[model samples]
Target: MKERNILDILGNAEEDTMEFLTEKCPEITDAELDALIDATEKKYKTKKKAKDGTEKDNNINMTENEVSGVEHSRRPAWLAPLLTAASIVLTAGVVLGSVMLLNRHGHNGGGIEQPAVTATTTSVTAAVSTIATSAGTATGTAAMSTATTQTVTAAETTAETTVYTTVPFVAPAAEKLYVDNELGSIALELFKKDDEVRYYPMGGGIECDIHDGIKFAADPELDIWCIDYSVEGDSYPAVHDIAYYCHVTDSKFSSLEEIKNYARRTMSENRYEQFFGGKMAKDIDNLEYMDTIDKEHTKFWIEYRGKLYELAYVGGWGKLPSVFSDFYPVIIADKTDTSYTAYIPLWYIQVEDINNCICVELKLILDPEFNDWRVDNVEQFDGKHYEELYNMLKG
Candidate 1:
């Protein structure tokens, strides 16, 4: 038998002849079979058109079956590709059927048994459908890439906030003393004396006669006093005056020299000049004058503003009939007037015979221009005398 090409078998051979070609060419693929079928159909149509004497322009007027010798069917022009693919499938089916039958008859006993033609054709058709689906997926993926190229933006903004703080109020030193009731009471009670001898207001004249043969005479103009009394039956007379005393005792200086040393050490040259009026050492030295009390006891005094003021007692006694007790000094600053004042408590002897004691008040004043406070005024009173004057000074 002569070896025949697959295209020649498809062009003019009948079904029996195609089966014979498939039996001869067992390795012919489905793709080669589909190409052979397409070429045979084109050749058959061209021969048929020439046999009917139909011109190429007149072929368009012919019905589907009349042009191809098949059943007439209406289809869209876009389905041309589908129709061509279907023809390829049909040709592949024919080749598969031939291969299946040859295997059933055992003509090639040594060859592997082939799958059924319907199964093979179904698998080929599925492969074609899968390729079409994969192409559609690739197109969808391209569209997705275009859609994925997008961006987001945010706007810039600003905010502002404010905060406030509170400040506490502090009262001035002078105003604090006047307004605070507790502080005023403490100031007033500082000089209050215990009741033993009562105070009596004098009228008409300074002549007053009291018990123990004591005579009291007062100079109302200067608030001075002259007292005559007998001590151990010995007649004696003394003159006294109400005067401001230095109030630095609260600093707890061990001695007068310490006090003077502190002033000298702490005060600047200008401050020393302003305070002592250029009489720092000399005046302070001269101010240390002392009066003898029968050689065994003595009384010390400091002269200021042309008057003699005695030293407050820490623990001592004297002949002038003065108080012997501890004195505590208090300093107060008045910022409203830029001034400072010090109150010195003068614990004085109450009665010459009993040794009872009371406090006499002394005040020192300092202005901003002065570095040291100057003894300014004094108030002497008891549980009885000068109550109104004490209250006025208290305020």
Candidate 2:
């Protein structure tokens, strides 16, 4: 009989036979069988003496040695491949069994039932699903982050673009007053109640109602006076309707002499000289000074070059310069209170030639809180005491 290769025998074996062979000799392989055959041939060529003084073939001992050598050398090399082949066989068997079972129960040749997936395929599918889910979560988180950033940016932009408007101011109705003997005794008595101010003569005179529009400060040591007043009506940009009333008053001295003496004490020599010798002196020359027993307040006005000009003086403080057109006669009225100075520039057309020249009238408003003023929708008058003057000037 022709010799058959062991690999061929295994390949052609029936399933039952192969299983039986595998169970009986699990470690046997074609290389191991070849080693056994080689050992047998060597054993036959070399005889050994047996215990009975007879020569014997050591084929069985040689076969045992060959089997041990093969196990030591090849066992380590074959283990991974054997495991991999066994796994492939097991997976294939499982798939084949499932397909066979499905085919048996499936509709006759019209439809085939899908085979159950193997463990490896199922594991791979599960891994892919997990990766897909993770990607989706990452995408959602990125989108949410972008949306939040946009919302915050939009809110910041709105804040930047929003404009703030100013608020209007209301006057105080009453304030406190201080009296000093050095400034000379005045018969007027002042007091405040609920937001209203009332004054009357200590020695019986006309009663007067006033607002907290006036403020007064005097230094007997320096013989200086600082008075602040607030005015009603519209003002120019950064300008307030207030006036700074400052001067010195002495009952024993004449008004002009007292003003000259104060100027000498407070002003530079040049300034004092310039004031008396300049246009101010000429303007003073044209003014008419009048006093009344009912109100000790002095009033000054002048009709100059067909225009009427006025001096504004209140309380015991001296006069402030005028800024309205000379053509418009202005009467000094109740002055308001403030802490800082404000300026309003008044433009007037010359009466001589209405189109020839434009004059600027710079008026000062003194308010303590000048810096705190905010521009709002409030109307400002040219001067609080100038309604009659305005009418006359207009005429």
Give, for candidate 1, the lowest lDDT window spanning 10 residues.
Answer: 139-148
lDDT of 1 by residue, 1-395 (tens): 12233334457668665444333222222322333344446544555544344333334346756565244444445445544655564555465445534432333211111111110111011121110111111110000000011111222111111000011112224333322243323333322221100000000001112111211221223322122222222222222321112222223233444434444343333333322221111133222222211211111223333332222111100011233322222323242342332232222222321112222333333433445433332333232222222333466
Off by over 4 Å in 1: 1-359, 367-375, 383-386, 389-395
True-vs-predicted CA distance for residue 131, candidate 2, Å: 81
Every candidate's lDDT:
0.27, 0.22
Clashing pairs in 1: 199-384
Count clashing pairs, candidate 2. Answer: 18
For residues 356-383, write the lDDT of model 2, one tens digit per residue.
2111111122323333221111112222
The weakest ten consecutive residues by lDDT in model 2 span: 140-149
Candidate closest to the true structure, highest TM-score: 1
